[model samples]
Target: MNHQSVDVNTAQSFVPKVSVVIPIYNGEADLPDLLSCLLSQTYPKEQVEYLLVDNNSSDRTLSILQTTAENSPITIRPLSENNIQSSYAARNTGIKAATGEIIAFTDADCRPQPQWLNTLIQPFINPEVVIVAGEILALPGTSLLEKFADKQETLSQKHTLAHKFCPYGQTANLAIRQHIFTKSGLFRPYLTTGGDADICWRILKANLGKLEFADDAIVQHRHRVTIKELSSQWRRYGRSNRYLHELHGIELTREIKTKEYIYILLRWLLKEVPKISIQNIIGQASFADLFNTPLGLFTSRERSLGQKKAQLPENAKVIEWF
Candidate 1:
């Protein structure tokens, strides 16, 4: 690591070292783009270290990490977590190996904006703030499912932070003080889903610190491009909802009756469908976006109903959806 010289006459500036932890599982296709974004970050390279954790990947993910670390100007540590299949477990491994005071997290598929790290770390300048949740938006997509996901703001942190029990940020774009982990304990290594919520709530419960949102700290994520992929994503969310309810007493959305389901479907088709038009969708949407935006809600709800009758697994293999 290189250090910049500072004049002793004036007080030196405070720049907290940041460790970016990303957990990956067969992310070969998306790794290049994500790495490019990381390498192009506007943040001081000397102050940031990236820990890319591979969670039992069966692809060329390990090879890519090795190649990047060899040629990259920034510090890149390629680590592995094969003992547990969960992404949270992989993250815990990265956390243990991280050397920075403030640890930031993004997925292997997420593309951070150039100013992401610089803006994300700014909140920690205040003593009261311990967690920083950055904004997540979808990368532009060509498929109907992808456009629908983008229109719905599927990756937004707003809804997650608005949880009734406690506000929490998804791991896609979040930063936390390293000391908070020691006080709150690391994330439940076995949790395949809802681990972000679990950890943030634990920190708040322990009175360790508070969380903040950074609007300018942005990361773009690729949305699922097919119906099967979209459905799988919602199913995971449903299972997460069930797990969270069991752990934190968070209430699940009541199941709709047969009559109510019919009513909603009819209402959406009869009343809402006609309201959409080229005028409203000109610059903002495509034909896919115009039709799928309203229809996706029903599909998402039905897909998420997996939690209603789902059995929680003891140690489920974490699937990388991004």
Candidate 2:
């Protein structure tokens, strides 16, 4: 869909300085693509800066950043957050170094459209909008897992924005005003996941500002290509659920029952098995991946159920939102 551009005349002088912050850990393989996207961004380079924070990667991620800093036309700042291993910590480091009025975040494996930043920040023309989230679409891939991700729209902002209690956005395509951090506080540095939701909720709960969704601001995310990688992704999600529940008293979904497991198995055998053709039998198709979805969900729920309840973080308050 074509982007619906905001009328600059409707708002009081719209343009604002923007900082694009990305957290990287052993992202050497993905850096080239991400950098290419950033360089191609249609946003005014004079009004923007890129902060690429390295979370102490063991690979050549830092070296690549150093090279880009010297050669790139756009301003690139390479910072490090070695103390903590979490992505959120790396992001916080970038946040501290950002000088732009707006802080936009995207992952190392994500490729934003040329107009991503320009479109993302348009909603901020209204003074009340503190958070703006963009759409996340899966990049095309040949693997079954990747195909499944695309089919489900796994990383789309719609899921989180439809949260039962309060909406949030993934960091992959979110932009926030710099001052919001000062008021709502930065993300929990220790969280390996779910920090985005936590910080967004805190901002909303404090009534700091409004959150807006910008469908035109699109970012394409790379999906896990293998079953192992996909399983790990879901497992982290399960762990995140536990952390969120502990912090907010959010209700958790019960463990998958044995009956449901049997049903899934039956469906796989009766439905999915019939879809298998010559392309599938020769390992040239993704038809078989459909069966793995149920298994993934089952494992995720089991992981969530088995996870030990964690203690609340220091100075954290439990807010019961039903």
Candidate 3:
């Protein structure tokens, strides 16, 4: 509730208010570190505000945020969104509650770089650019699933940009002018995943905002460490993504076949098996990454299959994946 409205005439320093919003659900364990990183940000304390929305957490997350805010140097506002059980819903709540001109978003598990906020809000200086897409890199990982997730994410972002996807950015590291919400609307509350891309596409397609990429504005994301975790997460993403494509009139050109998947697995094994150094691992790759080709292939297939199933009315519900 303690939000400072900074006006050029009111304050001599006159720093533009930048509100950083984060949505959390059962994030008690990670909130401390994320908060610590946020507190350490190089952004000006008087100009920055942290707005965190809790999605009916079942643990000590609320208390942790409240206690931290009490002693923190920066302005921290912690709110609760109990009506819905989705991050998008929490983000919407945060957006409505935000007092800053610029709203930056990240997750409870993500660690933003020191200059993340400064870099993200830079594009807004030009009135034409309303949305900024920051970089989401994987936190350093040694496990196979983690490394695979990171690699997949890197390729996916590159592919999205290369294909000229507009308003593209993950909420894990993104910023937008607050007025853009009133123009483009909030993220779909029903979607448990892919909401980030969904809103971005909507804003860009409607020509409501100009999206820019801020490569220097970065966040280190912790990818799922285990195969089961990765599977469930990607499956949810696939399902939500299918809903998104359908909503936007995007069509899949072809269906993946069992033989095609088998072929892909074979090709990977034949082409990748020889590149392993030491005990068959490429530079910086662990032994797990070298042997996880089959699992990675299977994961992709499951994600694809989930998307197909989600196209059906009977399988469109957003089931909790974690």
Candidate 4:
């Protein structure tokens, strides 16, 4: 998907300056590789800059960013947003500090491909595209939980177009025009999760600009390998659902019901059965997918806890693992 290159700033050009913002709490293990990748990006350094905001990390995340800032090709603005314990809050801080018309957001744990920024910013060439959803694939890990995490992300991003109003945009690989913030508003700082959907929904409902999917613009996310980590991740998602629904005036009695268990099992069976390479029933079946159905029960339970917090005036609970 090589789009014709647009000048960084031309009177009638769509290519405008871009600011890539990455929000992290404790990302020492992941930040270096991501920063190195950014330095290798094909996007014009003169037209692009980066903002790595720390949410008061008590780890080496700050030192690493300071070091990376000293060596990165483009200007790297290191900022802080510690008052709120939400990545969305950190992102808003970066948004305020950004000088580019195009603001791209990626997680600190993600290792973006070299062409990532170049590809992501391409759709902006249309001028009408205000929000772009780039592709996210999981970096391989040994654990089945890691594999499950990968599978879940693929499903989550792919099926978003079916959503009636706001097509989903994960911060792992999302780019938005700066003006969208002026019109659609910034990420809800109160939200610890799903603020991406909340803002994109706001934009769509307002008919601000085109929301396009850029499949070639990709990011590789580090999947949660342990059960505890995966459960915590889904719980935030569960809680965010409540917040989003409330904000939209949509109400649901149950987040997960008994009937859903059956549906999930059937859905997994249908999707996995056809691709089996074995003739024997055991060989044809995937135990991991089978286990994922029941795991959904645990994750949904976590979601229930989040929905419970949504009832509180201030949903400030933070998932430490995130």
Which candidate comes out best when scored by TM-score?
1
Off by over 4 Å in 2: 1-5, 8-13, 271-322
Q: Candidate 4: which stretches are off by over 4 Å?
A: 1-15, 154-156, 251-287, 312-322
TM-scores for every predicted model? 0.89, 0.87, 0.85, 0.82
RMSD of each: 5.6, 4.5, 6.2, 5.2
The TM-score that candidate 1 achieves is 0.89
Candidate 3 residue spans exceeding 4 A from truth: 1-15, 154-156, 162-167, 268-271, 274-289, 311-322
**CA displacement after TM-score superposition, residue 217 of candidate 2 (Å):** 0.7
* Native-referenced Cα lDDT, model 1: 0.82
Better of 3 and 4 by TM-score: 3
Clashing pairs in 3: 276-280, 276-281, 277-280, 277-281
Candidate 1 lDDT tens digits, 31-65: 98989999999888999999999999999999899
- Order of all candidates by lDDT, from best down to worst? 2, 1, 4, 3
Deviation in Å, model 2, residue 118 alpha carbon: 0.7
Off by over 4 Å in 1: 1-12, 277-286, 289-294, 313-322
Is 1 or 3 the stronger prediction by TM-score?
Answer: 1
Candidate 2 lDDT over residue span 1-322, tens digit each:
2224566675335668999899999999999899999999988888999999999999999999999999999999999999988888888899888999999999999999999998898988778889999999988788766666777777899999988878999999999999888887787887777788998998999999889999889999888877677667776776677778877667665667778878878877787676755558788666746556565665555466444444445533422121
**lDDT against the true structure, each candidate:** 0.82, 0.82, 0.75, 0.75
Number of backbone clashes in candidate 1: 0
